[model samples]
Target: MTLAAPIDPLAGAPGAYRDDLVEVVRTRHVPIGAIRTDSFAFWTDHDRVHLAHDLPAERIDNDLAGLVAAELFAPGWLEGSELFERLMTGLVVSAADDPLSAWTLFYRNTMDRLAQLTSLRPGAATEPHHGALVEGSLAGYAPVYRHAAGLIEPGSVLELGSCFGFFSLFAADRFAMTASDLSANTVRLLGRVAPLLGRRIETVICDAARVPRPDTSYDTVVALHLLEHLPAEHGAAVVTEMQRLARRRVVVAVPFEDEPTAAYGHVRVFTARTLIEIAIASGWSWTVHEHHGGWLVLDRP
Candidate 1:
């Protein structure tokens, strides 16, 4: 099978962690902020999944697809395997080199293919071990994942919009990456993945507007695909927060083509030019580039 379909990273939008796991120590400990675990297996319309699970465990993920179609049609959902496969393939191609995309596709396909039990949403609750694509999101945005297998020396980290704890959990291996998100459900899902990677973290449910700590909280702070969801005011607020939290640098990545519009809950979009201006305003010395998508690296003073 030549990977009949690709994956989607944002398939399920969603959240923490524990301590005493990291074997090597590098940075001084920052005070533990808070923790959350409320989003595990949150509510969704999974009537299709329940119906599919009724058929056979062997073909659960596939059978669910049948149920969803049948319910939407008559007596049961059917005649959809090909269409569903196409959609999955579309998502995979978009994020060719992103594990996050792999994880995303897995959930998207899971729900579309196995709907009898319920609706599928990708995030912290599902499998985190994804495509393991290294160069895509990281190489383009050097401050993070690019060549992550062994490039980072040792430092402190702070992350904005740390959904379900994947990045922070990934960061703990090389740096002191502390992450936070708005949903507690996201944090709970992250808590599960954290232990598996031999890493640990303290996550909190907090708005990006009001960071608990002020400037110099961490050596580096990263904000990825977060600006697109907020209004200009909120997006600007996040920059300030990242700037205040970071002791050394700030990193930001924005989409180029589907630049955020006012109505899509995205306040202001960015160009390499705008990104530089924003970083300067937020007190970061940033370098912007167009790689894979819009990429920016902000170095703090």
Candidate 2:
């Protein structure tokens, strides 16, 4: 099925879409018959679509929920039944055996939504659905970006585990920014899109725990929404790395869920107390607080 926007090369080619889905079937050793196609090729049974891979179901659900939530911010496109079907379709497609395909799809859709949102005339009236998709997706995380931006010190900044690099793009005007992620594909995509958006962001492919930078390499080091996806020991190591790489301050943010959200690939939860513990462990002057989520800010001597 055709997407709302044409799939460009950056947005996986039409052939790449088919090959990726086939690769998913091959990797999972699932029967080719399980694959179904419409808007996307997904694994399904005669009854309904199924997650036919080893990826965490909770993580996939979280990603799909973000897409579905966008619909809620601006209703009327699809009724209840149709929305449910859309959500299920997204889940199965996202849960396919190939994670790179899922990330590519997310990048394409997010860029498309943001493009539609930004193309609007300032203060101009438009249809409810025009920018609703992006607005809904940004609702939860925009505040986190704003808060992180506020805490940023003077001079250059590095964001580890930058994912899609949206926060880096948001703060590009105020600071020299560098976005780093473990996935080279994500970094490459961000590198391509940053210039297209008229922003100068340096993108790097590096692990957060062992970033190849000298001590105090950047004025500020930020890791928003990245810790929950790591184990306790690894999270601490990242904190140490952040401290080692920052001259001014190290900022860390995590969602305050009762339990980790599997759909987001979160392996643990963090609270105000937990953040305080992290701060104390760092042996630095620090502040722990919450707004959209828990935050731990460590000031360098």
Provide TM-scores for the models: 0.51, 0.66
How much does each candidate deviate from the true structure in C-alpha RMSD?
A: 17.3, 10.2
Task: Single out the weakest 10-residue window by summed lDDT for candidate 2.
Answer: 17-26
- Cα lDDT, model 1, residue 287: 69
In candidate 1, stretches whose alpha carbon ends up further than 4 angstroms from where it belongs are: 1-144, 147-153, 259-268
Which model scores highest in lDDT? 2
User: Model 2, 1-301: lDDT tens per residue?
Assistant: 5323221223322222222112222134456665432112345434333333343433332234454434331243222432343343334343434444554454455444444544454434445331243322544454567678889877999999997787787778899999999877558877876776677899889999999889999999999999998999999999999999999999998888887654446789888999998998899999998877889999987
- What is the C-alpha lDDT profile of model 1 across 6-61, one tens digit per residue? 22223322111111210111122322431111100111132211111111122222
| Deviation in Å, model 2, residue 229 alpha carbon | 0.2
Q: Which window of ten consecutive residues has the lowest lDDT sum in model 1?
A: 15-24
Candidate 2, position 219, lDDT: 96
